[model samples]
Target chain A: MKDFPYTESKDTRSGFGAGLHELGKTNPNVVALCADLIGSLKMDAFVKDFPERFFQVGIAEANMMGLAAGLTIGGKIPFTGTFANFSTGRVYDQIRQSIAYSGKNVKICASHAGLTLGEDGATHQILEDIGLMKMLPHMCVINPCDYNQTKAATLAIADYEGPVYLRFGRPVVPNFTPADQQFEIGKGVLLNEGADVSIFATGHLVWKAILAGKLLADKGINAEIINIHTIKPLDARMILESARKTRCVVTAEEHQMNGGLGDSIAQLLAREEPLPLEMVAVNDSFGESGTPDQLMEKYGLNETAIVAAVEKVMARKTK
Target chain B: MAQSTASETHAPEATKSVAELQQIATQVRRDIVRMVHAVNSGHPGGSLGCTELLVSLYFKVMQHTPEPFDMNGIGQDLFFLSNGHISPVFYSVLARSGYFPVSELATFRKLNSRLQGHPATHEHLPGIRIASGSLGQGLSVATGAAQAKKLNGDQSTVFVLMGDGELEEGQIWEAALYAPHHKVDNLMAFVDRNGQQIDGPTDKIGGLGDLRAKFEAFGWRVLETDGNQFETLLATIKEGQGLLGQGVPVMVLMDTQMGFGVDFMMGSHKWHGVAPNDEQLATALKQLEVEKASDY
Candidate 1:
């Protein structure tokens, strides 16, 4: 198994702020809008550096979505900042008609995603954003794993046209990905080359999958681990090729099993290759107030859960 | 037939007489009734109600281009249909003013046509800047476009037309607070105070009491216009345009009957989205005939 080390831990929202600040310096057409959550979203660097290009839209997510759509009309690439719940569900119609249907170039950068947005309860933590954004016709859904990857994805999406949903979390997780990695949308990164089972993970669960790979290696099971950052235009070729080698697959995410990374991978596998697959994700349940680590353990989204899922799927594989 | 040159780009010509605008509005009303009757599915009541306002803006007021339709619309005045159910009027004025072929009005709401049930930019429709069928979103969009104009140092205006019942949406109130606070003075917004919606009278559905006072409370420069009268509306728009660049956005409370042109369909909620049959179409056409202007 390939060892991935982290220097320190940092929130992915800070990565977005750093990337936005970089874009503010490089791209003149890049403008930022926030719905009264600059501090929480860690957008202070962009706001302070490019005060003229930033807009404080004040507590109206629907209006922010609309304004973002309209800004595209004048050839301005707008990045809207807010929480995951307010970004997707609170203004779905605004996004549907104004941004998605119109095919505007707006980056909906959502922070505090999934159960890791601890202690704020179910109202603030959003797990269904990936499903909601991916369902839109012209939307590109991306959930980067670590701080370095999130910053790289943020910079990469500025050059990409059309609507994008960049989802990141609030908690300070392991910053394991390379600092200068070229974040490619819809391209999966191979972390380990193994043949026993394939482990597909995204967002915060990616680091856990890396840890799970080591655990499986000790048990004489060589696990193939892949990080799927972009969810919508999934790296299907990479996933299928890995699945063909391993023959059994385990998908992990910090979201519901109903409409998340697991569901998307399962559909791809069912259509292309019939393989035994197990998902390590939160079952049909809402998240409540808890620490990020406690929530990951209780909801079965940690490395142990992924190891268990791999074992369960490997047992069901055809001999 | 002198072959109407009215559709040609009139480089900021704000001098067109009210009679000329009224003549175009009558022809536009005829197009609205005919287009809706052809589809048998559209909102004709609000379309007919807003006909004069659209005609005044397109033919007499807005400084825009029709030959080469630019999506950016940087140095040109832009318009957005907030309450996009009134697409019949929007489509009629756009086609009649030569954004596309005038004959394309026949393809309204048809399959594989650019004219969807709502105004959408996805089809690359010439005049539409953004898609709007869902209400309470246009004002915010227009405000953003206005901000873009300011960023580019382009001294052009952004206009948006909305329905009275659309105000019941919470986003409208959010935008109501946004424009004034942001000093989005280059945007001119109009509310079609037509007193009726699809469910019934707006008073019975959800009363929007005292719009002038409501807009004033939101720190906007409010003006009222008789939307059915071309002369009064042109004057009101001229006055409203004067209030631009004064650190406050402008709002026009346009008083209009639900079905303004056709006597039978007038002043009621029943015709809000209902199309006219053959006999009703003939009645509406007879009332909205223009001697000089030709129908598409």
Candidate 2:
């Protein structure tokens, strides 16, 4: 296992805010629009610095999406901010027609994704956003793990010419990645190398996978951990290469097991290299109001769950 | 592509008289019926109804270039077809206005054609800035483009034509409120008040009571015009253009029959999306006959 230490915890949304502020200074064409969640989305710095560029589209996600598409007509790269549910579900048709099908360069930045949006319940905590966005032909779906990685992804997507759904969480987790890391879309980050099992994780569950790697190492089991941030245009080459060495895989995410990262990996492995795989994710069920820790525990999305999943997948591995 | 800036002013106004525009509209109506009939599918009622409105904009009112089709029409007046089901009319106007070869009209709704069932930008189709088959989205897109024009310091107008029945979509109301609030003064919107939808008459299905009153309440300068009358619509567009940039978007509630040009297909919602049969097409074309008519 690799020695990955973190000195502080920070919400991924703040990382997005920081990246957006940087883009405001660096890229003249980059513009921001928020749907009545400026403070929640942590877009205060960007809004203050570039008030003219920032559009406060009050509480209308659909209009925000349409305006974002229109802004692209005049060579403006628009980034819309809102919660995950409102971003994907509430304005799905608008995104499909105006942005995705139209092939507009609109960055749909969604915060408070998955069960990490504690106490808001299932209504606000959207587990199907990755699926919803990835299904669109032109949309690139990205879910970064830590604060630094989220910031890097935010800045990188601005240069990408197409619709993108950037998903992050509200909870403050480990800020582990490098501050100046280059974010490459559709590329997986290898955190640790092992021979027994390959652990692929995304979003908030990536830290838990790291902790699980440590636990597995202590128990005489070697685990390879890879951060699968960009869900769509998934890094199949890395996955196949790691799976060939480990012979088994365990996927983890703070989303439903049905259409989340696990499903994506399962489909890839089924086609190219079949292996014994276990998924640590929420089953087909709605979440309830609870603390982040409690909800993660109840939903089987913690380090302990990952460790158990690794053990199970390893046990099923053929010699 | 070179930007078609606002400084390249339009040709002198009133170059074509009402009679000349009416002749072009007759040919456009002929093209709409033929294109829809060739595909054996498309909406013709609203197309015929809005023929004069589109004719007036493309040939007389709007200052746009069709020869060098630029997606970012930075300095030119832009138009979006919100009621995209009436694409036959929009495609005809665009083709006749020299956006593309008129021969391409035969490819409407065919395999691998730029003229999709709805107006789409993905095909790189000239004169189309956005895809808007899905209703209630164009107004917002036009408002966004209008804001972009304002940001670019372009002194040109952004026009969008929508369906009255499409007003039931909540997003239309959302954009309606947003345009005036943001002071999107560069936008001039027109609603095809034909009082019909796909299912039935709009009133029988769901009434949109007092559209002018609704727009006025939402802080818009409302204007009314007879959409099927070429002279009335041309004058109304000129008047609407005069009302722009005073800190309010203009809305033109154009009253039109569902099927205006053809005598037999008029005033009913049955032909909203249904294409005319071969014999019916002959009858409709006969009614829209024009001297020296050129069919693509």
DockQ measured for candidate 2: 0.76
- Please compute the TM-score of chain B alone for each predicted structure, in the order given: 0.95, 0.96
**lDDT of candidate 1 over B192-277, digit per residue (tens):** 99999889989888889988999999999999989999888978987887888889999999999988989998999999999999
Q: Local error of candidate 1 at B92, Å? A: 0.9
Tens-digit lDDT string for candidate 1 (A215-267): 99999999999999999898999999999999999999988888899899999
Give residue B6's error in model 1 in angstroms: 19
Candidate 1 clash pair list: none
What is the interface RMSD, in angstroms, for predicted model 1? 0.7
Per-model CA lDDT versus the true structure:
0.91, 0.90
DockQ of each: 0.77, 0.76
